[model samples]
Target: MMDYVWFIRWFGPSDIYSTQLGELAHRVVKKLYGLGNKKRDPRQIGRRLRRVEWAKRAFDRRGIHTKRRRQQAVANKDDSITTHYHIGKSNKKRLDLKTYTHSRDPAAKGFWTKLQDHILGRLMQHEFDGDTHETFTDDDRKHIRIKDRKLVELQTLRVNYTTYDIRRDQDTINPRNHADVMMLSPEDEPGAHPYWYARVLRIFRVQVISTHPLASTVLSGPQEMEILWVRWLGVEPGYHSGFQRGRLPKVGFVDEADPFAFGFLAPAHIIRGCHLMPSFSDGRTAGLLQTSEPTAARKTDEIDDWQFFYVGIFVDRDMFMRYFPGGGVGHTANQGFFQSTPDNAENEPRGEESGDEEDELESDSEMHQTTMPPSQAQAEQPFAIDSDESVDGESSHDSDESFDSDPEGDDDLNETDVDDWQWDDGYGSA
Candidate 1:
């Protein structure tokens, strides 16, 4: 049937009457009339109809309900932290702007007062002369003035607007120094060997202006915060060291770490701590920091080769010495300035693959066995049986053997064909 598939396709079924032409014609007629709901196959039509109905139902649905949305809490009179400020949505919503809730900071009282006067003066272009004051009662005039002042303040300040002091401590290890190295956090790449190295570019402490989950935990002083900005050195196509083989780079690393060499940012918590390495002149030995130390202020070389210490993960002194016998795993000048440790010894290949392996040997032996002449197979097993033997094993005997001496006596045996002989169940002699 499979061999004749082309014939079946070329010359279809002989009987056209047996085909479902009638059903197809009926469907075509129904489609022309736009008669959807009728005697239809539910398996075929039900799903399509359901999808259409679903789309129709979803067409006019509204966006997220106000209750379901997470609303930000703004500063209020009831807020306990008077020192720290916050912003909340105001009652009046105009255009797309929500008026800023009034700040009760004691420090801003003078500023707010001056701002109010500046705003009111612009509105009251005309002087309120005695003639204007005489028309309204003193209480009414005062109330109007107060309301206008409040309105101006609200209009001037925007909701969600904030400001904070960026405190800089020159005492701490300055990240901008470029000498600072940090331990990378495991959370950066979860479910992996997360300890990595990065060079710090900047560090600063500031007051957090926005609400976030980590705000409370991260804030050290009153509204003050700290974070470390870093530039990550890539691990993919990573530099191998004396100890370890490189890992297949995770997609996250490849995607996030710009292969073309660009900078990326990570928070301070993601940085575990600072790591330091000793500088050496030879770029190999890890003796005292003195061997590399400037001894009599020697002239600097044109192509400076005195770069030995790098910002990276810290291994114990003993382990480092064991792995790197020369005290440092120096990089060839062409490669990047980083090194990697091997994963495991077992997974590393003992030697490169070649044609003379055990598998190749087995394959060669098989080919030799297969190509040998039939005469060799006969020589290997000359007495091999080709057919089944009878229960009495008579067929297995050599044909040249002599069996003319009959067990039964010659007088007792009658003339009969040996092939057609019929004997009693028990031997008559026995």
Candidate 2:
């Protein structure tokens, strides 16, 4: 079971008091038994145990603590924070607008302009009730002012979210480590998927000040705020991704030309980190953006993007619950946004292939409100796609805890096929 591994990281421990201490004690006793010879000298063993106990007592009297004990002390301090989530450590030196906007790194390109509009949007909706909040306009955004244009870049984000069992769990997201994330979607379309997926490109907390003449009543001073810069991902058109299919959902990066392709995200809206595997068989292509202009969306000088990626929903237990109907009790806020339930299976999740003649078919580019031309995309791949033979594999584990082919709780399957695979070919199950 991977439960012995990632599940522990996901939910912390089963309880404040755990059974590992007792098991470790037994292991120590077995080592002490080795001190006895073949004759099984009981008295000799007892004498050695007593001396060991004496040394332990003496060591404790000196007030020295083990690494585990010191870590627990720090964890206790973090538990006192009232919010379910909090930001963690980062670099000490802060970066200004000039450093970011003028940097040669592709990640920093156009960051200042996007951040300016983001601040204006937040300021416009500061204290409004219901749907009456003011929104950003072309004229309104230009008038917004920021204090000193200073920003603090963060390295880690610790998010504590409710699990499927109605318990709390935490996930740590880092831009370089665990960047993929999921968030609740507010859309109410029928047969719509419940969550929005994105990969965090950068993280920041800046002081926002609005100097718009029409918004003087909204603020008196600068307001400190936190936001995540993310590259939005969309589900593959006409892919069957559900528990019934036993295959993970496929998602891909939107065409870089799309306006909302990259935007600021509120950390408060994040659910947890997600695991996405590249669908190697689909191959890489440069048609998505097809631009030589410098972009923050992709790595420097990188001309191609992965054709598709699979959302590994089965990677962890909590992730599975998030997608299953009537399976997540804590996801009440998004109760109505899940895929079509059993009662209404006729309408599959948006972007899924349908056989009905009346239903309008959505092409890959049509899935997102993008102005990018479809003429540049793969003309061979039809809009009404069927399950690709590339994803041919079955879950070999028999038990619920046995999630994958590996029994040691490691994702050995995904790591397979890399040795003999060539860059020209796509990947399949190991």
| Residue 32 lDDT (model 1) | 31
- For each predicted model, how many residue pairs clash, with residues at least 3 apart or on different chains? 6, 1
lDDT score for residue 425 of model 2: 20
* Tens-place lDDT digits, model 2, residues 201-297: 7777777776687554245677777788888889787665565444577899877566666777778778888998999999998777666666656
How many clashing residue pairs are found in candidate 2?
1
| Whole-model Cα lDDT of every candidate shown, in order | 0.29, 0.60
Candidate 2 error regions (>4 Å): 1-81, 89-91, 103-110, 126-135, 213-220, 289-303, 333-430
For 363-417, candidate 1 gives per-residue lDDT tens digits of 7546544544566446643222232235774343233322111010001121221
Off by over 4 Å in 1: 1-172, 176-178, 184-194, 211-222, 238-430
Residue pairs in clash, model 1: 74-87, 74-88, 243-342, 244-341, 244-342, 245-342
Q: lDDT for model 2, on a 0 to 1 scale? A: 0.60
Q: Model 1 reaches what TM-score against the true structure?
A: 0.22
